[model samples]
Target: MINNLFSAVSAAAAQEHFDELLRRPGLRIERIVSQGQASPTGFWYDQPQGEWVVLLSGSAGLRLAHEPSERVLSPGDFVEIPAHCRHRVEWTDTSAPTVWLAVHFDAV
Candidate 1:
């Protein structure tokens, strides 16, 4: 089967959209679409699995709990988040939808 990652995106959505692409033992992949969305104040994500995410289109701001400043991400930018590493999405492009490809897997 063939799939297009850019298809079926809704920029007018009320919240960030997540689509699971594939799942296997100890691994999963998903696509995330964000448009002018951000993490709720005082909220952070601490996941049991490690994540490797890439910005496919548009832009965003991401912050790691241990970092002093947010990292500005543009298309093609990627980040590797270790398991249990707290992080948050600070902001996303308002004029266009931001596309992200995320792979989650058990940490070695």
Candidate 2:
């Protein structure tokens, strides 16, 4: 039995990405801690593996690719990203801290 779990601990609470988070075979996990700011303009995430994003604080807006609508997220909100679905972070809380927990894994 594995009794230990590796946790991603962030020292600063601000907007960031997973570019330097971690890497392993078929899996990646990231902790995003943010405060006040919309996502980068017109930038989207194209993932090869299915992704799951959970909001731990504040709020956000997600615009899915090819979709004409945007979804709102707040504390305790969780979303699943299917492989190959292009998506973008439209906006986020501009007055408070927003934290996110992202989990990635390959489909079997």
Best by TM-score: 1
lDDT of 1 by residue, 1-108 (tens): 789999998776789999999999999999999999999999999999999999999899999999999999999999999999999999999999999999999999
Candidate 2: how many backbone clashes? 1
Name every residue pair that clashes in candidate 2: 14-34
Off by over 4 Å in 2: 1-24
- CA lDDT of every candidate: 0.97, 0.74
Could you estimate the TM-score for every candidate?
Answer: 0.97, 0.74
Where is the poorest 10-residue window by lDDT in model 1? 9-18
Name the lDDT value of residue 11 in candidate 2: 39
Give each prediction's root-mean-square deviation over alpha carbons: 0.7, 4.2
* Candidate 2 TM-score to native: 0.74
